[model samples]
Target: MSLQTWLVSLFLLICVILCWSVSAQAFAPYPYDSYYSGARFRRGPLMGFDGEDTQLQQLMQNLKPRPTLLIRIASSLGCIAHIHMATAGEIVEVNWLAEHINDPHVKVLDATYEVKPKPNWEEFKNTSYGKFDELIKTHVNPNYTAEHIPNAVHFNLDVAYFPGQYERFSFYSPELFEQYVQKLGINKDDKLIVYSRGPAAGMLFAARVWWTFKVYGHRNIEVLNGGFNAWKSSGHPTESGDKSATQGNWKAGPIDKSLYANFDDLTNDPRGGNLFENKMSAINMLDARPGGQFNGSEPLGFPAPKATGSHIAGAKNVPLPNVVGETGVKDKSALEEALKKAGFDASKSTVTMCNSGVQASMLALGLARLGIKARVYNGSMSELALRASEYINSK
Candidate 1:
């Protein structure tokens, strides 16, 4: 054959091979070797193609990659950057609150409530720091005066509800909430920072108070991230006495319906209440109850007439301990991972429910840190068990 013809044939063959290889890489299932392939595309190699080709790179830049699992779940779930920016004012770190503790307009509150089985006081008697009887009466029972942040008032969740409400810790009526905070000397304009004793349940309790304040239309409210433990561990000053203050005019603002969810919302939900089986729900109904309780293997252990062992029909168990870690709410990545592991769809709206709405608030707080706004089912499993027993799912 002639030299010119042979050269043209060889060049055409090489070009065809290159095109085929590019097509295969571009369409192959993305491996983890390079960032351009898997979840988010970076416009470089298709699947770890080491060689740089301007045509291939430009083609990739124009090609749309498949959305990540989380992105496919929901675009409204928000991203990590959005999460960090959004979480700034909702929770105060220990140092920030310490610096502002003395500010007059800032009101710090110890919203501590015990949800565990009663501790045997006799065991702590000898190892106690001071007079055993006095300690048990004042400190052990959270209802009374106790050690707290300096200038911080005690917010007793036990009696925060209206007289005729379902039970203790049921959401308070607007008028009753107004009277409750007024008695604590909180004014409408006060910038409230609520904290609790433990990182898990305590933080949840504090979040519940924060949620309540938000529900009543209090604009300037936040939770102390790590609560009392964070404060004490950081060497922040704490006093062992009740805070005394004259009443300030705190009126209940119009209720913010968006933050609170009722039983009917659950029944009307599109998730159809069983993410555990179907895994394709428009709403992520999270049950913050422990695994045993969720599966009906363990009792709720509370005296309330609430159903002990079951969850709302469409809920997935995420548990309180998983939501709140040793350092308050888990970091955004960790929380997202935990929720994802529980079959959470990042793009869907979330409604959190627990035994008494406590852990739900905790999960809400964690979701808040992730920049995902979630509603709390204030009439949580307690109301569900009593009113909508049909929706309760037992293993």
Candidate 2:
């Protein structure tokens, strides 16, 4: 062979070796036994060249890539990078989930909790539990059983792991949260992609699931942008029937307090004087409800009893519809514009609340996309409406 051809071959070989090394490093298990994307391989026999590494064997068996030199190289470099950065952002594109849908390391969850309030809601104003019961039968259950993203697990958030004696919107206890996660077959290091279809084809309930994961110290999770509607619109695949997952060994870590705010934190904090009355204060309280509900012009939302259209007197109304676009959560630039138009003060500490905790999480997710972290009031207005008379009168 000519000397020039020989040199070219040497350069190509070096690139291949470097790419392989990077791929292995990208997949290697992190310290503290964390996961990188979903590739949590044991540290042994470089990429399992020894042929006895069970993890490597499983990986190879699971991924039946085309047997071509170029394909192998591309798979190593391109595909590994894709997996490595799968959960890097708060949002993942439909195309990315489509490409990695079959990877064992990637877990997709459908967190759809469709809310259907009655047309004449005042008749059942005091029966929030009945509304929830009705939605489970008519909306949430049927939607998941009828169609969902291929291989997506159903994350039943409303009542499955709920505490028995709290107001209906309470966060699950740490133990119950752990049990729920493990049952979903989630691993500590798994790349979780959560999606939901809103009443009008927007992304809604998934943000609460993402927030719950973050609250329990799991960071490798992303919301599927545009949600199930986006997947269908793009002509990706779907599954009609429910499927079971092998239970995962996933355990909950210590709660991350910064991501959560309880009722006491909102009511008693020295920095907060804004929950009961409209005032300029240290914290920015953004209510993710429509102007009508926030200002007492419309009927109460899903489960807020007694207080039809009543909100914390201090909250600036930043509706969920404004925070999320027609498809999903707005893109970064659009989100920033919306927040600005809604008079969101980025400098102040933010606490988001809606009727329940659901819409608040969507606002929190939008703030997160803009690199601003905000707390979700787990109790939200339901808790507030139930007990507001106690605090509102005292304050």
Candidate 3:
């Protein structure tokens, strides 16, 4: 055959191979499909993900680190809010929520944070720098003292997300996150809803609580759209003062760190090897903040030390859009396509991180629909800003 003919044939052959590969992957079995329809929403790479081995690993492993203490807070069998999505949720919102805002078992907690002037400087401590607006102005609960929604308890987000310069922000060890949850009279079995001021910060905060419950195997959680602002806009009442209630033996479950990404984990591990690189095809990162913040050009919050770094090492930048009428993460086809070209397979792993973890939640939700195995790093820019030198010296 002539050279020209051979070249044409080779190109066609490559096309045929590509088509077959994608077809085979499409037909691959999904055992979880028996339960999770949401799985279909993912947009993963056909070439990279090795779910079969991982799935088998899941089956072969019967070992649970803290099986003895774990409880399913929301189960298909139990969690009230989860079971009655429309009806019970409505009734609970009306009859139970307002009256029980002061309930011993239901605690409506607010997890808020403020950025420090320097990345490593701690916040919410005894300092002139710890103003609430600098933490996250949009999600503040000003109404909590005025007339808090019923069946709620108030706690500073610091109770869970306290940060230190020497270490990644300290989380309420599973034990700590759990104890605080239970101290508010919350349990594995109660219906729970977490709200924020706007969807980004609030959703991120709510995701932390939701993740805490889920990692402990508690599933009955929902994030209120638009947080306290939405609540008040909807005419809900807010109250003031910290309300404490009876506690329960809310045991901590095995720490499932798999659902979240840690700064150290992203920086060192092979799974997160692509973390700081811009080649999306390597499964790097996606920033959820406005472009300026991610680019290290804008001040993170009014009182926050200006953001530094070119975002999470190597991740591509895609500012969350101001979707009309929708405040949460919106479906953006263009952004999704960009991610695909960059090697960010929704079926594979990606860590959504922001200054304080709240904005990342918006990115996580958007990625979730695309079938990406995404986890929130939980620390926002503050995590890096506080520890700027560590990243600066290395990169």
lDDT of 2: 0.69
lDDT of each: 0.67, 0.69, 0.51
RMSD of every candidate to native, in Å, equals 18.7, 10.4, 15.7
Clashes of 3: 41
lDDT of 1 by residue, 147-167 (tens): 788888877654464211332
Q: Could you tell me the TM-score of candidate 2?
A: 0.70
Point out where model 1 deviates above 4 Å: 1-88, 116-144, 163-168, 199-201, 268-282, 300-309
RMSD of 1: 18.7
Where model 2 places Cα greater than 4 Å from the true spot, the runs are 1-87, 116-140, 160-166, 273-280, 301-309, 390-395
The residue-by-residue lDDT of candidate 3 on 1-395, one tens digit each, is: 97756975675556555545443433334543344333433334332224444453353244233212122211111323322443231112233445555544455655433433333344434452333334433334454544555556655565444555533345556665666566666666676766544446345555556555655666455555455555666566665654556775666677666657666766666754534432334555666677776565664553334333445556655455631124443445654665665456455557676666656655665564454556677665666655443342111
Candidate 2: tens digits of C-alpha lDDT, residues 1-395: 97756975676566568766655443334431233335544543224234334555455444444234554576456534544464278988999999999999999999887554313233333443333334334434678879999889888776433422324445556676676677668887798999988742456788888998899888889998888889999999798887677888887877677888877777666765444553536677788877887676675544434443365545677787777777777667787777787688878888888776788888898889888888888777666655663332211
Model 3 has an lDDT value of 0.51
Model 1 scores a TM of 0.65
Q: How do the candidates rank by lDDT, highest first?
A: 2, 1, 3
- The alpha-carbon lDDT assigned to residue 22 of candidate 3 equals 49
Task: Report the number of clashing residue pairs per model.
Answer: 4, 0, 41
